[model samples]
Target chain A: MSENTTYREAVKRAIHKAMKEDERVFLMGEDVGRYGGSYAVSMGFLEEFGSERIIDTPLCESGFTGAGIGAAVNGMRPIVEIMTINFSFLALDQIINSASKLLYMSGGQFNVPIVIRMATGGGNQLGAQHSHSLEGWYAHVPGLKVLTPATVQDAYDMVGLALDHPDPILIFENSNLYNTKGELDTNATPLPIGKAKIHREGKDLTLLTYGVNLLKALKAHERLAKEGIDVEVIDLRSLRPLDDEAIMASVKKTHRVMIVDEGWKSGSISAEIMARINEQAFYELDAPMVRVCSAEVPFPYAEHLERAAMPQVDEIVAMAHKVMEES
Target chain B: MSEFIMPSLGADMESAVLMEWKIKEGDKVKKGDIIAEVETSKGVIEIEIFEDGIVEKLLVEPETECKVGTPLAIIHSVSERINISPAAKKRAKELGVDLEKLASQTKGTINLSQVEATDEKTETKAPTTDGMRQAIARAMSKSNTEIPHYYLSTSINMTAALKWLEELNSQRPIGERILPAALLIHAIVLALKKVPQLNGFWQNDTQEIISEINPGIAIALRKGGLITPAILNTQEMNLNETMHSLDDLITRTRTGKLKGGEMTQQTITITNLGDLGIESVFGVIYPPQVAIVGIGNIMDVPWAENDMLCARKVVKVTLAGDHRATDGRIGAQFLDKLDKILQKPEELL
Candidate 1:
């Protein structure tokens, strides 16, 4: 219980715990069983559950994803691992067209208890193909629950919550954060999907973000704190069915908002958040909403190019300072 | 004959550039006519004639910077004879005594020495970099110094109002969709129509309120700063028309392309914070206007009805008024009427 573990280990332990506690739960995806998952988040699970339970699927994302959906509909809890969000596009037919729609399109006949885990966001120079933060894209799709666990506690608990959800769930883990380690309270209960956590409370401005950007926002928050700017960092762990109540509550106290997202600028989650703030908290705003998003370009192979393409700590800090000055 | 003293033009400035003249010596003038354009730190502002008469003498020429309170021109009435003061005549002579030549060359009193002095000062002083910032500072300073403000806050249930908006939006195109801000603006305009007393200027000297419903909607610009652009004659406009006007004003404001009449002549203001999630905010009453309405965020809260608690969408509205012009009773009555109008949003339409 007191052993040092990586973020990847924390997630694997949570999955193992949930699967062991419930016999209905099983794992399925390419390399998830025999290969112990592409990121090793399911290492040693195949021996414990066997090939039937720990399903090693073909490279067909749509096919295997469809299988996961079918299994979930038939009263089996299925966790589908997509190697990376970059590969999820192949499975969009099953995820978006099938999994996301089953609950609503069926008029509530079928509840798709499917958890689709994907490593998202560009950081390790995975080139344009492998690296992408597609959480916003998934969040935009209705009937799909999107969860991004930035901390160990969240990573340990979100899997349980996603399993409990009677709908399709997309959980994004940053490839760069796999080695990040933090303490986890084993007895911690599962968190509600739509609730945002204020990791650091400050009065100057509210930094609203989720996923990998949450870490970037926290870094920016630390830098700003040194400069005497009290930035309130809100980690929107769940993207869809957004916790506007939590966001607005913080906004009411802070009076300024700066959204941080790793997605491209236009039509991103930041735009939606800004619009909601404008529609809901217009009077409380002393300044207009600011967003720090990834550069609207394809990810490049060069380390410097990729770093520039993604939203950085400096950019977030600058945005926070700008909002602070406005307030 | 009466001499027109140079207007202060603005605070902080002791002198203003006499940029141009609309009239010359011997020209007949009427009160309220644009007599000249004076350049200050703010902008080139038109100076209006105060009295109806014939221009017998002009004391300040184009390009001349004259001190405030210095005589700029002499307007002679039909019953009064023009008398040139000996001191002014001597001063004019010492500065090169060619009255006819000066009038012919400049069409006004050519204060050459004053112009030379101002030119020397301009070269020595650093030019102001931010004109809008300077104007805002001056305006804010003046308002804070001159106005006596009092704030009153009330919570309004927007449950019925939002539902009405949803119903209205369902029937409209995406472009014509009714938003909460639009509905609030409409409600505020209608409320002003009912409480016309709040929509006016307070003449502090006489302690009288002059009513006009020119509603200023505070627009937050994308680049920086807040500006309250006025929507003239709010009382006469329908909900759709007001919404359309507000949309146009905000579009212009965000683009930094506001027309001349958009910022000035506001009789009252509405600062909406509903989008930013603030429950209620107390706003400082902009000077001249007796009151300003601050709209807060809409949220679900428990409300008591028949001794039972029920969830309802409530918005906090604060009305900041000049106590000299309005009493608490009048403010309370206005808010009550505003709440009623907002609750029954269909009445505004």
Candidate 2:
């Protein structure tokens, strides 16, 4: 059942499966149809599902994003593909005001079943404008299901599950993970939204992370294991509705937590996790909560500067050392 | 000056009576030396010093029932003192604050607000333990109400096992005699391996099988309540390791020196009433965990072998399991496997 595939190919298979299963489902974006995709996410969708299902729109994020909301309110499941998360800012009014509030503002008479997918995060020298990790910003807004699938199996399963969600869903895919190859289980089951997966079992400290940083934490955990410092690495598949039970259970065992996030440190998702840990498991902690987030800067252009700006495996290992040894 | 306070002997002990002081003022002592004997709810424990110093003053008198953190003596070392705020000193006097806690907070000066903040924690030590008892009560009551538990009992021949254990003990010293409880625990865990359904928690609408066979021994405290701390990974250990771990667990359980995570990750529980000479026991299931096993006193009984009557040593084993997690048939299979393992006692080692 294991099919070795790239992260981009897994996503394309999920989209391909979902569109074939339902006629109401379609993909709409700037370059998703004939131009293949900005990152080839919907590369062959126009040739297979036809141009009607593979909608190629103008270079306007807000316009197409609003159209997704309109189609969703009228009982069509349209998956909006924003080329990059940096450009999602241009569609803020559509995402926040219309898609998010349609069901509640209309007294539950209307519901938006729109799944918005975007290429997010740093690496690959995407520079400042194209490389951004703002999934945390969308997580702050209510009525939006924010999912960040970190594994190949999850990339194949998460999108199809999001299509059935009644409200809007925002799927954040890391740009760095597109070429990362992994074994995708053909019989992969859909993971429930808001639940986290423990990538490695350990007893020293929990490294909570999502998306691209999940790999970094796993790498650090492996090296830490060799040094006799057992660390638990958790990939938070869902960004919002933080799984407090999983977080607290790990913290209660380890009594320490180090969050690795690609987002900037200030007011990032890591801050939210720290606050939750404090509220729930403050006395259980043997040491202070620590985090290794991207350095507060616009995504850098140079290779060295970009690597320095974002979270690295070495930083995660160092943070784990601080949490375990500083006590 | 280093202050020695009344130590909380166990998680349940809020206070203890200072029975005797082994050292007097002007006497020098080293770390790890027994300095005093305090009578806790469990029993009298000889407390040890963690630092080297000269006894400067004996603040507490004998036969005084002091709450935990009440200063007993002051030991002066070669080091000097840091200036404590006057308000902090007054607050410490009023609250009888434990200065060791403050030392960890700041190595420099102690302040008034720190004492005020720490006072609430010390004041509610009793309630915190009561909170733990209440937590246990909640889980037990939840198990009782929600779970439909079925009890099963079986009598297994123990003649081969008792003879094997007696022969094995002949070679060991008097101080290292392996008790029958260790063999019972070994049999229980091996049987659990064959029937793993009884070793996991039924929670979150899922039946998760706990891989590690951690069996909690229910040790009744001398004070009043019972604390069940587990012997971790008994399946990975031999009969000697199991005997040593069980002995260590009991001593630490009574003295309140149990290791970290010892009481938390109990996959299953074992209650042995053989020591009390009880015929059989039916223990309530500790919630989260689905099963509780009981071992009774081994006695000589008349048995039929190949259509002939004969005398054989047998013991009653009872299992109370959550019907939601497992059935009566599974319980029978587990007991059947246990009976088979008892016949081959060498496998336990």
- Runs in model 1 lying further than 4 Å from the true structure: A1-4, B1-349
Candidate 2 docking quality: incorrect, acceptable, medium or high: incorrect
Q: What DockQ does candidate 1 have relative to the true complex?
A: 0.00
| Residue-wise C-alpha lDDT for candidate 1, range B1-349, written one tens digit per residue | 7898788866787988889998899898888889999888888989998888888899887999888888999887544432332223444555455544334433222333333333343333322214455766886687677777777888898888889888998999998876788788878877777777788887655444445577888877544567898887776787788778888888877666776776788888899877878888888777777888999998899998789999999989999888878887788888898899987777768
Docking level for model 1 = incorrect
State the lDDT of candidate 1 residue by residue for A1-327, as single tens digits. Answer: 445567888899989998889998999998998889999999999998888889999889989999999999999999999899999999999998999888888899998999999899887888888778878888898889889999888887888889988888999988877888888777767578889899999887889888777888888888888989999999999889899999999977777789888888888888989889878876566566798888878899899999898889988887777765543
Best by TM-score: 2
Best model number under lDDT: 2
lDDT of each: 0.81, 0.87
All models, RMSD in angstroms: 27.0, 23.0
Clashing pairs in 2: none
Model 2 residue A14 lDDT score: 88
Cα-based lDDT at residue A268, candidate 1: 85
lDDT per residue, candidate 2, A12-74, as tens digits? 998988898899999999899998899898887899999999999999999999999999999
